[model samples]
Target: MSTEEKNPIIKIYMLGRFALEYDGEIILEDEGKIHKVWSLLGYLLANHSRKLGSQELPELLCADERSGDPAKVVKNLAYRLRCLLSDSGLPKETYIVQSGGSYSWNERLNYTIDTDEFLASYKRARQGGIDEQTAIDCYLQAISIYQGKFLPHAVYDQWAAHSTTYYHRLFTDSIISLYRLLEKKETYELMLPVCEKAIGIDAYDEDIYRIYIHCLTKMGRHKEALLSYETITNRLYDEMGVNPSGELRSLYREIMKTLKSVETDLIIIKEDLNEGGQAECCYFCEYQIFKDIYRFIARRVNRTGESIFIMLCTLTDKEDEIPSKKYLAEAMESLKVSIGKTLRKGDLFSRYSHSQFVVMLPDISYENGYMVGKRIQAAYKKNKVSKVVTMHYKLQPLDPKHF
Candidate 1:
């Protein structure tokens, strides 16, 4: 409640390397043993000007710490940061404000924030036009401005949602732009590295894998492309206990056929390339469709490190006895007929678990993934099942070499 601490000089502080001011002239830097809690404050402030309550601040700061009361640590850190800011001649009523149970920054303070400029420029560039080079330039600039992931050292905080979202947008946009440019130029070699980097940042992104697959095919690396299917297949099986989407499976088959040119020998030569096969568990019965799917993945994904695909499902509260064998059999028939009409010949679908199923497609990207999911959902809807069954789908692209 003291006037001295009422409105401490506010400065735009970036939470990277060490807490450093982006715009303050009389640079107030902390080099000696910087408390994790102090870093946590910088993490919260970096998000936006918000009233972080006293009760909430400590919890946010100490969320990852196992051995201390977050409340006490947060209070001490705030007091410590306040002294440092004041001693460094930070503007009065600028840096931070302490209210009853909260702490907030004065948003009106004048300061040159790299983050602000980066975001503004990025927004402007993207709004320019599709396939605009200016947008590409601004996106690179934004990537540079991102010192590190928002609050890299700050274990955890509830306010990190915004920063995470913005970071991903910038990253995804950059990758997609590069993909388009590379595709136009036919620079397969150059496109490979960029797509790799994007996948490293977000492995679950299907677009990255799709781009990789396309680039590989164009570059005449058909065998490698098929091998990649195995890697991604294993990953999805491990992480989500599911497989790639149906579009990808179709792509895989198409690529294989393209790789093996037809000969006039009148003899069908199957290239020993890895692939999913139809199961004979049920002859003439469509209920074996789900079984065929898992068997397909099991045959193909015989390696490791690609375990990020997951299948999550929730059953309707009422009439919940995981679909019986007969019901599943009926659903399989419906799915086979539905998918047969909607999907290409080679698409693969597997049972992820009791309530969920996965459709795997090797080279298909977002466009096909969306189409596949929508059609399948529609099929489930149009068919009159005995119970209220709902399925939600998520698609992930896996690292090809990981397997």
Candidate 2:
């Protein structure tokens, strides 16, 4: 048997986590130790195809420390890395080679890198004239290989950051291409899991969520699609302090439209409408729903000649400065509850910003609106809310002509 057959190739995983697999045994870096050892190893492996000068390694690896002799530190790190490889049962001499004051990963070593294979598979998948199944198989392989960002441990490193971005873009593109191909084949169910996995990898990616929701809707799972949309939108708002994109919002509307089935029984429709039970106070809805209510009320004001006032409640520090995120979030929740309990049942309210709430009051005079705002502030203070958080309100008349 050849030498290659006698020993299995060393497998290095830089995605999600950095690990080494040799002869079916996993090797991990020692935590809380000198990070340069592993950092050097990762850097060399990342640029394995090219030779890196010893002088350059010192600057990159020891950029923060100015007290030591950088070249000497790098040399010692190299020696320590080789010892680590040998201790891990890898042929140390066959892995990292030094010549002319430079180091390079041994090209002839029996080794495989997950990233190299990932890129290679992706390139093959994109080649012209390949059969659809072959392309799909390549894409699936590539996706499976990319567990997460490239070398997450070295994410802050400039080189690693660039590679991470490139690989992630490629991975997302692969998912999109795979789903489009599945759509062509009329096998949307198969696309569901792929899109779902992609979302788990990058939850903030709206495009992946859009595709996943589309697949769910395509399979007649409108409820699941709607739930997914709600879950993502809530998460986005809570974490990023922003709403979903227009595309995702439009998708949500489409899902809601699909969920509406023609029901002959008026009783069933009424029950569905009152599923949340009678409102004890103001109607609290999502911002989008609140906007819809605003428009409807604006149109009605022209005919009924009823006055409507919109109040914006803002939370700030004692000095009128925006508080910290944690404090602001807590104060906002308290403000929401206070407004809900203080406003009338016909009133509408929604969160307008990270530290603001917009409330709608109909059939109320301007003076009454100001009084209502004060009532909300009093309720909020009576609940023993943070003293650092102070409430401020401004009232504006909702003009029907603007609608």
Candidate 3:
């Protein structure tokens, strides 16, 4: 089959990143430079229905240079852009045209633009007949096309930013509609994946979570449904400083009821009730909480005469340099486990950084505090993945009452 016959007339991709393909082959360009040629072409094609004023392109592209006339630069760039497109096995004027103090795509070429096609499919699906299944299929197609923000690499372009916001709203709306229709049909098998993808795209949407919870409940996956609800609420708490809605709380109460009745295994129920927190080490919380506790202890030590010691443990390579991020992360996790095993039941420890651990040994003498730090170092070293991973420590002993 011929190239033109076998492929899209011209394919323009602006999702995630930006690229163009005429027929089936990717159009090649400069080895490294970000050229204005293709970006302008994409803008024209994306806004194909509207005419862009001459000044708009210059302001979007060449606003920073401010050396000469931006309009002249736009004019020159337009000619170069036409030639560049023409070199891509297309006619000189097949895709771009200039008219009446404005520029736009020729609109004559048989072409498919990702954003346009997505929007068109979305509109038709919403306006189509009352067939829920067909609407869902169209929504899936649109969602799949939107891999990321519109023209993600071209952040400076105001038009691209505006288009991105518009498409994101459409994408979420489609998910909201599609999930409702699927839930109405009771297609839990297919609806689960749809809910997951929708969550992956927009984790904060309570509407998506509502349908997701319903699907999970239908499939008897109440545990996973509760976990997902907790995940979203934690995200909201940490990221948005908000709580889950009353509707979500009601759904969760029902899940709890189901779990209580469904789990007939007394052993499992017993484990869930009794298997929380360890006495080997004290509570771990946010770094700020750790610091606050330390300050409170510092204040009491003056009156209590309690020998308080703080230890800082850091991971280092055998060569005394910081390890790679992967190694660092693994070493830290291992160190955390080892610290938990080595600390006494009442001792407190918190991870202070990716490579640092802070521990409080209260009521211990200076020598015992030093020994505790050594014990942590020994435990951390035992779990090292390689000889390159090692531990270094600093211990501070404070007895404010005697000072």
Candidate 4:
């Protein structure tokens, strides 16, 4: 047999990192050197079926540089890439073919790229008409092959950037599809690790989190599901400055419904509710819980004729502009402590936005509510928070008729 026939098929990985493997040996680019050789080679290989014009190749490879001789630069890089392949112990043959003024990858090379297999598997899985198990197998294969975004090292390159987005979308779609199949099969345990892996690759994908949480709940791991929900929600707020979608919020309600066990004894329920110990300050809850509390209070006001007020505390710069993230975070923390200390335990508060908090004060007059807001500002200053952050407050009476 010829050397090429006897050797293992060369494998090229282009997902998380660029690499070439042959006969148990792996090749990677040198860290300190410019990657023109690898860049030229990767582009050619990615478009192997068609030839790239010699003039176009230089511009594509060195678009940012003002090369004195673009043709010579392309020639030198191609030579270096050929040497790289030769030194890697493959059969000595031309990998880049030049015809007239255009270059193309050798069609006869025996090699496989991860992206090719990934795309094929993804297409097969989504084409439908296949059996459930077969479709699932295809999806799992594609998911396993997709370690990360395509050409991560060349993300800034226009071509690589477009391909990166395309592949990432495919990977996320496969994950969602896999979840549906697994869910239909009622294989919650099998999906836990898959969802975890998917989340690691793309943390901001709410659909993956929803599927993960659903699987966890199905396995009766209510605490884990709740923890995941809290984690994603906090990350979304802190990083993206947005709230969870209504679908995610609805899923949270489902988790809460399943989290509690059936209990007839009021004493046990009371103990469960008081497990966190005596309240040392005002009640702090999620925005959803705050909404529920506000609604209940609005209803109760009609019967008890008690006064209720809502206060909005906003953090801004001296010019009344929103503060920077660092300042806003520190000021928000300090403000939380201040509100907890100044307000009565019966009062409720929640973070209303990236730079604001909402407080509900029951059984208090409008004047008292305003005073409470001033007390919070005073406490915030006493804590020696940054002077750049300014606190602004607005109060409105809670009217039952508006409920």
Give the candidate number with the greatest TM-score.
2
Q: For every model shown, what is its TM-score relative to the native structure?
A: 0.48, 0.90, 0.62, 0.89
Candidate lDDT scores, in order, read 0.57, 0.84, 0.73, 0.84
lDDT of 4 by residue, 1-403 (tens): 1225655777788887788787777855434256677788779878878989867888897788898988888888888888888887776778788887788888777778899889999999988588999999999999999988876667777877888898999988998888888889899887888888878878888998999999999999999999999989877866677889999999999998999989999998988989377787889998988998888888889778888899999888988887877667688889888888999988999988877899999888888898999999989887555588988899998889875
Tens digits of per-residue lDDT for model 3, 1-403: 1234433576778766677776567775333254576677667877788889977888876866774888878777788877777776753445667886689886666667788778877887798564877788888888777766677656566667788788888887877777777778777777677678767767788888888887898888988988887777656543454567879877877776786556788898988776365444555544445776888887798777678888888878877876666577677778878777877777778866556788888888878888877887777767637466888888887535433
Q: Candidate 3: how large is its RMSD?
A: 8.9
Encode model 1's per-residue lDDT on 166-190: one tens digit a residue. 6667766766775676567687786
Clashes of 1: 23
Q: Give candidate 2's whole-model lDDT.
A: 0.84
- Runs in model 3 deviating more than 4 A are 1-8, 28-35, 89-93, 199-210, 226-255, 260-268, 271-403
Per residue, candidate 2 scores C-alpha lDDT tens digits across 227-259 of 998878766765677778999988987887889
**Which parts of model 4 have CA positions greater than 4 angstroms off?**
1-4, 29-35, 83-93, 317-319, 323-331, 378-389
**For each candidate, how many residue pairs have backbone atoms clashing (under 3 Å)?**
23, 0, 0, 0
- The lDDT, on a scale of 0 to 1, for candidate 1 is 0.57
Per-candidate Cα RMSD to the true structure, in Å, reads: 15.8, 2.7, 8.9, 3.0
